[model samples]
Target: MYRSAIFLKISLFFILLILPGTVACYAQSYKIDSLSLLLKSHPKQDDKRAELLLLLATEGMKFDPKQGLPHADEVLSFQNAIKNKNYVASAHRTKAGIFLYLSRFPESLESYNRAITVDKILKNEVGIGAALGNIGIVYMTQGKFPEALKYFLQALKKQEELKNELYVGIMLTNAGIVYTEMGDYKEAMSHYQRALSVFKKYKHFVGQANTLGNIGIVHSKMNNLDEAIKYSKLAIQIGDSIGNTRISARENGNLSGYYSKQRQPDQALKYGSIAIQKNEKINNIKSLGFNYQNFSDAYYQKKNYALSKSYALNALKIGQEVNVTDLKRDASLGLSEVYTALNMPDSAFRYYKMYKEYGDSISNDQKKNEITRMGMQYEFDKTEAVYREKQILAEGQLKQQQLQLALNRAELQRGLQQTALQKALLENEKLVSEEKQKQLIISQNNEKLQSNKLNLLSQQQRFDQLEIRQLWLYGILAIVSLLTVLIYLLNLSRIRKLKFASTLQLREAEQNNLKLEHQYQLSESELRAIRSQMNPHFIFNVLNSIESYIMDNDKRTASRLVQKFASLSRLILENSIKSLIPADKEWKALRLYTELEAMRYNNSFTYSFEHAPEISLSTILLPPMLIQPLIENAILHGIIGQAITDAHISVTMVQSEQTLIIKVSDNGIGLNRTSNKTLVNVVKEKSIGLKSIRERIKLLNLQYPGSASFSVDEGPEQRGTIAVISLPVLGVGSGEI
Candidate 1:
């Protein structure tokens, strides 16, 4: 009865002291409801909406912690949708608080870290400091004192840079709490004293109260009972003055522990019950469980075993609900002590065994956390190394690109110089052609003059003959007349013979000049044909195929194709200037060309090369780039054009005594089956390569009768085309064949 009276007096005193703060809390609740209504009415997405959401989250946390989570999530969603990073950081920080309240430490840390990252991007120092402090709190909850201390000090430094006394005080108190938990009372007291000074300087009552409560915990740990009591009472008075149940609950719990150690059971019970009520009202399950265990100990000290057992059970239930290992450990110890006091050995033993089991579990969990931390550190180092390597590679690539650009500029300049040189050559050729035309006109004029002179001579000869005839008749001498007639006839016959020989010589010279002009045109056409073999479009397509192979990681195939391309290029460059090349050399170049084409088309067709065994390749002579163009036409116009899936080409050489028959056949669409008239016309008209070869054959035939002839027709199956060329066996000029 005396204990009940004392508890009643203490409860009444606390109620009176907290009455004003309670009314203020009621007004705050009204503001929260008004904000909720305002948020619902506002349809516009703006900063106003973000502000209202934040307010709702902060106010909702006072009564229903879980209620704040949705509001915080909405804030994050709204900020993210608007692409406002600064506000997003705020929203994340809010969510971290809600997660922490829900006892989700990992989620809390994740959210706080995300907020810090955003703030860093924005260069918002204040936001970063706050997030760091919150992260420290999460680490502290997980019993990572060193990590918690590190972050708290970092946040304090940032706060100091900003000269934000409130946050500085709050972070210092947080750090002090971590030190106290680690049992370093001296270091903890030093931080608390510095924080107390900062809070006092700023006149921030909440920061002051929080720091005071932390200081009390440190004092209690050091067994300084008087100083601990003084700090605890001062913190509780500050909390009651502000109507903050969270602070009051935390301070009162501290006071209850102080009183329990002083062996004042009634006073400890009084304060512990009040703390439990406040924590329960605010949904602070963690603090409520601790207060309950403290109440159980008070009851045990007072020899009230039944009540102690009851309170211990209550504490155990709350610890289980919250899943706080520290709460569970404390509850188990209290229950064991209570059961022992009640003389229930079995029950005591059971709880003592549970306490040891929880202790071991906590130790294992700490070890696992240590390993996880180490792994995270290693991964962070690895990621940093990779980032540095990528950065260096990017810089090197930039330098290489610059060098390539310079080279390209130099190449472009040289090409311009070459174009200028070509222009100059064209001008010189124009001058030469004009001079030749003038010379031709002069030669024609001279021939006209000579014809006129010849006409005059003939007229004179006619007159002289008439004169001689008259003289012979008048002088009466038959012999003289006959002799004169004979001489006239002889002179006339000699003149006619001389004119015939001169005309024959002039005709031969004109024929020789025409032949020379035709030969020059043929040489120019052959150069064009060799260039056309590696046309821009075909080269581009091949390059694209090489790129695809490289991107596909088929480097072996790409390398082989590149080498073949180089070989083909070398052959074209070397043979383009020559009129004729050995049959074997030409065949090798053809093979390389075909192989590259096949690889470009992903091996779409197969080809074979065969020759008569009786013929010697090295001893045979053929026009350079003669057969390749025919094979290309068969592939591009026949197989590729018709999209033949099972296409084949065969090149065969047959020796027939004096003529070498070279045949190229493909199992592709025949001439009659070709549907694109335009393409067919293009193939025929633009086949300068084939035309050039035909001209060369004509020239060869002129030199060596029946040297070359070509024809094309449908293949044996009527499903493909074949090109046949017959060239005389003019063996390598040595008659080796």
Candidate 2:
């Protein structure tokens, strides 16, 4: 038994060196080698071998599920043979992972519970955390996202404390994917971005690609196609660079969908084909199914009804084989669309009905399962409460017994005192009798009285000693009670300080969040202003042209220009009141102003608004009346009274690095070399609009610090003022500054 204990401690020491999520093939081989040595030394080392086998099985599950299952079975058999309860618990956990891969969810759940029980008995925190995380994965696979999230969060707290960054990133990405499925894009993006940062920092290329792919999916859902494309391309690039076929295939599918949504059918088809080919090469059933669905959608957009139908059917078959309900739903939707396009009403209706039924059934099943789980949880909590109550009752009984024992001791002490008092009285009487006898003789009478006085003095001394002992006992008890009170007060003061510190930390975090939100809002407002300014430049230029005609004494042309300028000014003023105007309306205002400005300069200067299809003017919001000042500055500084017939201005809005980059550049003289301050400070001091923008940016910085920025510089490869404002990409529901 002593040798066995020593061997077990040694094995555990080696296990501690193997980090979670890093037990690769080589690590498993090392563990196996160690197990063989242990078996040779201790011929009856079945239990130790079983413990090592469980770890080996877990490692194998990552690469070879079939091989892992046999290892798990072997571990379980050894545990049963040796009747080792500790190994039995761990064997169940290993078996659970194998069962999960086999899609035997009920058995997996049971095995996980068994592992949890054993871990609890062993006080194994890491094992408990792992079991919970695996259970969460099971829930996720069954489409129970909320339940999965609960367990995942619990596991995450433990893993974070353990500083298991690799597993932490994986869990974060999983949680984010669940949120994406639930349509909580903002939260999903936050998690995915955090995971991406971790993966990049750790140089985990595959993890980075996966996170980027998920981020792309979120942006796609939010209708930010350009951002979706950007992230998807990044994922593809990283995956390709790392030679990770799985990530490459997945990203290809994402890009296909992004291109299809952007109405780029040719690019969509190209990527969809690449995804399918890569998935085929890797034999990834999940990726293959998504690839087929993407191809079907791309084909449908291209009006290839026959090809669309074929791909959709293929996707449906793959989805059903894999039991991927979401994929099946998408396939059905795609088939319905293809049939409708082919003008087959009856066939289209059939697929549509099937799609609706499947969707409803999935939803109903989820709701029922959630209700059942909640009921189970409530019962478990009730049982726990009852057990706690019993524990408390037992403790109370023990305390009562202690108190009774103390009381009995005090009573016994009093009884002893009474007995001593009786003995003292008897002795005193005896002494008095003896004294009386001695005093009988007439000549010895005085000597007998002196002896009686001496006996009384000895009795008084004994009584005083007893009194002192009683007073000492009372003083000790009083001091103990005072000391206990003092200790409690000291503890209370420490608790108060802790509470204050916690409150202060919470307040600081809230203040920081508020600051970030304000900064985001300010950046958003500036973007709107830049967009709004695009229109007024053309309007003012047209008015200037009409002034030129009036000075030239062309009354008819001047009158006609005045009428057009008046109408344009009214439209601009009306549109300026809105946070966002239609792209066409903004274009019209820009055209009118551009024309007027051209007439004023005899068509020597030119300007244009370059629109990207990615910019959805209707849904996008900008700050009202923000752009005119910059354009005015450009005209006043760049073109006015200048001999530069080649002068031109351009305004562009594009999203890059999760920031909306708005640039206003011109072919004009650069900043005055004589200025003592930077352009930003000069704007802050002299320009009301710029100052307002700065104040707004400051407020936004409070909310989204370091997320948005603005700067004024010469355009790259061009000699002109470039006023650039970079705002974080905010969603539709995001409010104005």
Candidate 3:
């Protein structure tokens, strides 16, 4: 019977050991399944159902956060309806998972604290440990390695007591990732190796692949190119065999990065392309973004600027689509580098500034989360103390009743002390759990804050890119406009010069035509005046001769004189109408005039005509009837009335300097003082032909300006007049007749 009693005690001990675990497992399953069903239901009940939903929601969150969020909301609504602290805490925990997945890290952190509060109130050490582990993971994601490690270690102790190896391994792996990011490759490798061993012992292929890929990434950061490539390739192969394309893509991208760092552009490009293809096939937008970024780097290394820019832009697009803040930040950096290489310093600087701002924002967010987490831990500890006190009071009441009936009070008392110690230990563990949960919450919040900062940076980069494009467009337009204006101005200047040249030519031609017309008019007027003067003189002389013949009654002499006068008159009239007459013709006219004068004087005067040897009579030309009047003046005025010893008048012509020099001189009683007046009057009244010659000279001077000159002067060595004339030396046979 004593053996049976001992067996019963052993059975009770075994039962107690298995009971908590089984109860915890059953409760967790019930909660998860109930939450899933409640979420699946089209409609929910009221506040009481909401409390049940909160319990289920927290349990469901471990496996399926997407399914847990609505239940969490229901629980929150129930807490609002009933003001239940426990329900509020459960809702907060469930919501934390949802928010964490949504990247709402600040809200998730707050929710995690609320959950920790509920766990403290219930004095649930395991729950607090689990929550702390999750918080540690969040911190790891945020790169808060120190804070995350502290919580993780605490969680590790709780998980060891619970013998939860899988969760412990996951936490270990996360710790490794944080260390790797911190550049503590050795410590990171150790953590990863420990996690890898645990995963392998459990036959967790996915976990193993993840750990291996992370190890490769750490090696890559350390610049162990060969080891990085080897491990990455192995991870990719394992992931591929297991149909885990997400892991495969990640590993491929890492390998590509390794190749890129080694400056093997071809190999980098090959792996990067494969990674992109796999990511695309799997519809993994986040992985695709990373792969595109890697490809951009590879192409950039090859100096393919256009392709590099395109891929970088594409990576940015995918990162935005996936809402992957880290990817977006990376893509923006790549794009900035591309622009910098392309000589777009402004764009590069803008993106770099955006990167810095986002980084600062991330740091600020981490600080806020850390503060909140510490505050929540403080609150959880207070609540846990209250729960511990309540448990002690209940144990004390049970012990008092048992003490009254005990035969072995000492043993009973020892057992009571042991139980009290155990209770005290549980309380200590609870405090540790609360501390760990706070640390994890802080870490998770920091991670979310970092993600938000990265997103802001990406948005700023996009804006900068748009601004850059606008600047380029404006610059191009301005340059084109400036060039166009320059061309127009040049064309306008050329046109103005051309017009000015045309106007100058026209003016020159018009001036020449005006000069020619004036010369021709003057020549015609001279000819008319000469004809008018000579016609009247010839008529009066003929009439005078006829009358003298009648008075003398010598009919035959009168008749001969009249006929000669008529013939001379006809010759003079005909020659006056001609434009030019030969020099010989002008001499003949002078001889005729002398003959007529001799007839008038009746042999009182004689005349001689002389020509210089240099004068070519055949080629020479003179104005018509110009010499006749000059001879008439000498004969009529000088020789007619004077008693001259030699009544002879000589006409001589010579050529000098393209001019005609003619002298008609007579030796008679030289002009008396009263006779000079009479000679001047006669020149004015009867020397119309001389006046015509003067007008012709004026016309010639106007026509050929400085080219011709005519003047009359007193004879140098004779009592006669000399006429000097200059004309352009026209070639032989070129003179007008």
Candidate 4:
């Protein structure tokens, strides 16, 4: 049993060393020239230069480990000159990764400790988590499984605190690797499963591939070859789709071994060759050694002694160069088999002795006892399941708190509304009273002036008639009667003019009040539109769908859905901030929103857009998302509500001289089922999207009076609804600023 344990330990350590790691994923494809240019532009010893240098070093570490060391050294040398501790910490972390890649365990551990100290001083949680994980990797490589688990768990705790799902997944996978090597397959699988959940949640493709590949390895160890092949292929597929060459190579190598175990030598050879080619392309020496060993194993299974011997020698060369203990052990085993098959007993015995020596080094009593102790401790704690229970409880508490906060916000909004209404009422009453007071004063002044004018006219007549007394007495009396008639006519005309002027003033005041009321309505409608854009129901439904995917363990789909939802929300927010946007921008936002809505509801309907060739979408400007509400109503009411099958919504744009016309038509249970009248007629009962559309049109027309118009009516035969919006052509499309 101890001998078997020794062999298993050596083999597991080799597998861990050869497997592609999640940490190296951050070194994804980057242009060295771009980094060089950036560094050149930033001056020597500058913080920005140091930052870019670290990025370049990170990118180079996995592929060219030696090249990255000098870059890391340069960063450290410049750190004292730079003020930012975070940069210095990142530099140390980069150096640690390079040393780990080069198999310098002690050096890597030292650098990681330095990084941790700097990160602690800077309070950099993420950096600290990374350094901890790196240190753990070093310990794991050195066959210190329990010690590695300690570091991994510590890093995981930090990752959880930061809520960085991707890093958390990476740490979980690392812990699982440790457990697997400790002969605790059950605990290993549990951690891998949890890691898969997190990777899927965030759509971390590299992490997903790593976790899947590890699960396959675990299954392979359990002698479940079929299940091992299933997961290995899945890992390969994900890696291929995401263009992760290194991960794909590692999975292919695993598959090759799996097929070889199943005695499918031909299939084994095919995947082994593929792994070799990919590793060559990436210049991955560690993975190359593993691939070569798998190739030797496949050929050995086929009884091809000569070819098997050649491949084993190749693997041994790489193993010797890299100095990985597990690789050399596996290589010796393969060479021994090749020699035995070739009928060379002496050579076979010599290699077998070397393999035994390697196994002996791996199975020391202290290590075996440590593995047993850690496995027992893990089984007892059931840490992951307990953590999940705690998480679920905390999530429930958070939801309750959020609900209370929302209720409080609603109450505050209601209070503000009441205060505004009261203030408006007071302002209206004050204006009305002031107008009445001015009218009363004008009436009193007019009456006094009229009385004075009449008295003055009478006095002038009396003085003039005395001079012409006896000779023109009859003429004077006739003139006084004519003057009296004239005075009465003048008074009547003045009174009529005053009444007409007062009526005009009253009419003006009424028009002003109507304008104010319309303005208020416009504002209310805009607020409603903003609220609808951020409708809680829609958000809740999207979140529910995402939750469903998470429950189903379909992380990729769920992550994609979340991304689309976020993009739609961002567009809505940006549009709300702008009164007008280019037609193309509005179309882009509407299209994204339509697609997201369709996805949320399981693609129950489809949509398309048609723009007139003559219209320049980039130059034409319109109110942002003006037509989205109408489209939403068409889908929600006309299509979804009515259970319309194969429903299609079409948006068409046409430019005619000085006017731009947009039409939204949907083939669903048309206007006859909903309403026979235009959308305006049902405004009182329709959604805020529709009501806001109406109010917006009114406001738009006021701004450019008679320049915008919209009408909603039943389509041909009333089979569906058609909404048409017309706006004055400001100019050719100039694109959005």
- For model 4, what is the error of residue 514's alpha carbon versus the real structure, in angstroms, after optimal superposition? 56
Instruction: Estimate the Cα RMSD of every predicted model relative to the unseen true structure.
Output: 46.6, 21.1, 47.1, 34.4
Worst 10 residues of 3 by lDDT: 1-10
Worst 10 residues of 1 by lDDT: 5-14
Residue range 297-355, candidate 4, lDDT tens digits: 77777788888788878878877876666777788888887788788999999999998
Of models 1 and 3, which has the larger TM-score?
1
Compare candidates 3 and 4 on lDDT and give the better one: 4
Q: Which residue pairs show backbone clashes in model 1?
A: none
Clash counts for all predictions: 0, 21, 1, 7
TM values, all candidates:
0.45, 0.42, 0.38, 0.47
The predicted structure with the larger lDDT, 1 or 3, is 1
Q: Which residue pairs come into collision in candidate 4? A: 618-733, 618-734, 618-735, 619-732, 619-733, 619-734, 620-733
Model 2 off-target regions past 4 Å? 1-64, 81-111, 157-170, 197-207, 236-246, 265-286, 321-323, 361-737
lDDT for position 451 in model 1: 92
The TM-score that candidate 1 achieves is 0.45
Query: Which clashing pairs does model 3 show?
Result: 139-443
- Residue 204 error, candidate 2, Å: 5.0
Model 2 is weakest, by summed lDDT over 10 consecutive residues, at 1-10
Task: State the displacement of the C-alpha of residue 495, model 4, in Å, after optimal TM-score superposition.
Answer: 56
lDDT per model vs. reference: 0.76, 0.69, 0.67, 0.75
